[model samples]
Target: MPAVLAHAFAPHSHDSATKTDAALESSRHGLRALVISFAALMATAALQAVIVARSGSVALLGDTLHNLADALTALPLGVAFWLGRRAATRRFTYGYGRAEDLAGIVIVALIAASAALAGYQAVKRLIDPAEVRLLGLVAAAGVVGFAGNELVARYRIRVGRRIGSAALVADGLHARTDGLTSLAVVLSAAGAALGLPLADPIIGLLITIAICLVLKDAARQICHRLMDAVDPALVETAERILAGVPGVENVGAVRLRWIGHALRAEVEIAVRHDATLLQAHAVAVAAEHRLIHELPHLRAATVHADPDGPPGADHHAILSAHR
Candidate 1:
């Protein structure tokens, strides 16, 4: 019998149970952050909308819309995280992890829409100027919006990093952008108070441009996740773990990708050419075990065993071609 085999490290129900529990725990953390942030944003936006009505600051109105969009974004992300908890199906071998990335795309679209709307209003205000009233109250509302968004941004970023969630991290960054634009509302209020009435709309235009920059960054992050780009350090760590396995003579290709917040790997290890099939299998298992033990986020690993005599692909190709 051929000594080469591919084995999934998870063979026991206990391991599956533990992994499922961990995934659920991660999802819970994300959900909690989303709920709190959404509520905070909604309250902040409502307060600011009241000010927008009373003061007629186009800049404040723009900030209010951004805050509302930010709050609504939590809904899709919450659903994505929930879907990510679902078990893999025959039709969807990787489960619903990709939904997180799709949610991220939706966020980017929403951000773009807010930018377009803000820019349009800003340009209209520039063409037909309006006196901004109650400048002090508008500034105060901007401060409130900034405070709420910054708090939510910090919480989401901290939890997202802990759980290894790219989508959540992007959302946090988006909130940070909104907070910064809220500060731009303060600047607009200040300019209006100083009698440069046109400054308010100009600041709104500038805020719109800044939002586009943030949108570019968030889209880049989401695209990287969709493209299966894991950190090089993670790949190095996997290789090191494989090398430390006693019977592994050589470490071949090592690949890691994130499915939602969890990571899975496919690794190739070379064992002694003269080793028995049982010995090779034992070596592969040991390597797999060490990988799972050392990498906290690694949920599953597929280890491929090959003879130590030559490179795995060339040897397999030569053997198959000869046969």
Candidate 2:
């Protein structure tokens, strides 16, 4: 498995109990916001689509598609919220905490794809301009949609960030797209009203470009996490956890990865062969607790103890009799 990076993505919780208060509360509130936002966006997009179709406005049509894309983002997060609460299984021991992250990745990809489609259509329309009627109505609709989505996006982002849910963050990105699409429509309408026929298609392409840029960062983050790209600072954090323990001489093999929203680790520690099972278990338990305390995302830990001294050494972490 690839090493997940700490900075690029929200922490993983591959092993923690999602039943915990913070996770539960965050998921609840964030999911609620996403559901409402998605509903409102769907309605708004329908309205915008109707208006744009009637007027033959490329910018308004693109914005409408953007609003529809919000549904794709919100629906996945809602499912992840419910699924993430399930217990770990034999088939998938890590639990479903990562389902939300996967959902986020899918959502970002959807938005980016929508943007690409919009840009292509906009360019085609620019090549063969159509005479659109009633520029004022398109502008009016955009203003109303912008105001509505702005409120929803702002509130959703605040709640999502509080609980560290990437699903909600991706949903917030959807809402933000609506806000920006509205802003673009407003500019396009103004230019249309001022007798600039090219503004509508131009704004459509601009909105599409913005979506691509935003999604690129999100894609990079998802790819890095899946690749287990650990960073210098997080590795340093792991090193500190091992070095500080009382009986540990050094950590030999440190296999650390984000376990969902938590860090899961397997470490080999150097210790004296004279150490009893009880002593070693205690040390390992202490180290596990400290690792969890230091990194809130750590879900599970296994510490293997290796003898400090000679080649003809007695077992330290596990006895041969037990083996």
Candidate 3:
């Protein structure tokens, strides 16, 4: 026998139905978070906009724009979650999980655009200094902005971690960055009230730099997801699980990848050459069972049982040509 491949998926089983329900529930949770966070952020931005118009504060204006952009990111992520709920079609074997990663790309682009706009506005104000009026209101708006963004950040990070969503987590981090920049606006107000006339524009430039840092972090996360990268600890855990299985002489290549927020694994294990086909199949099934139960967020796994032939005898010689 070449190898026995056992898959954890069984369409007609109750277990499969449960898994499907769980996936849909996760999508619903993602959409709910997006909607609530979106509303909160929009409200915060609107309040800031009013202050920006009255005070003519460049720093507050930049913070307001970033808040608006961050709120809009929810649109793409919401659509991605909805698409993820769709059933897999014949042409698309993996379903629409990849839509989340694509949404992440759009989010990164938006962050970059906001950063550029903020930078330009800051530089312009720096060249031609403008008097920032209503210093008190600007300071109050900054405090409000910080409060709102921090709340949204906490909520998003909580839900994102629960659902294993990289995009949502990245967005949450982005919101936290917005909160920090919003605090900078208060410093600008203080500088204006004191003696430094250039403090408002200088703070605006600092806010722009903060946005750039956030952009870099978000881009890195999205790129990792697109590249199918998983935590090394997951692989190590999988190997330990397989090695503990009865009749598994050795564990070979083990791979894990995220399909959206869920995980899928492929594993190879060596069994005694004298074992019968049924024995090998049983071992493969056991390994798959253990993996699914122990691995967090693992939706399914395919286990392959290879016969442990003599050291010099190459069992894969026949398939060498194909390779």
Top TM-score model = 3
| Candidate topping lDDT | 3
Error of 2 at 245 (Å): 3.7
Off by over 4 Å in 1: 1-15, 310-314, 318-323
TM-score, cand. 3: 0.94
Candidate 3: C-alpha lDDT: 0.89
Q: How large is the C-alpha RMSD of every model relative to the true structure?
A: 3.1, 7.5, 2.8
What residue pairs are clashing in model 3?
none
lDDT of each: 0.86, 0.71, 0.89
Q: Residue by residue across 1-323, what tens digits does model 3's lDDT show?
A: 23333231111111377778888898899999999999999999999999999999999999998999999999999999999999889998878888999999999999999999988998999999999999999999999999999999999999998887878888998999999999999999999999788999999999999999999998998899999999999999999999999989999999998888778888899888878777777787888889987888777787877888867888789999998
Ten-residue stretch with the least lDDT total in model 1: 5-14
Regions of candidate 2 where Cα sits further than 4 Å from its true position: 1-26, 230-232, 259-263, 271-276, 310-323
Clashes of each: 0, 16, 0
Candidate 2 per-residue C-alpha lDDT over 43-112 given as tens digits, one digit per residue, 9 for 90 to 100: 8887888898788888888777777887667887778777776667998787777776677677777888
Better of 1 and 3 by lDDT: 3
Q: Mind giving the per-residue lDDT tens digits that candidate 1 earns over 276-318?
A: 7778778888888889778768878888877877434455775
Pairs that collide, model 1: none
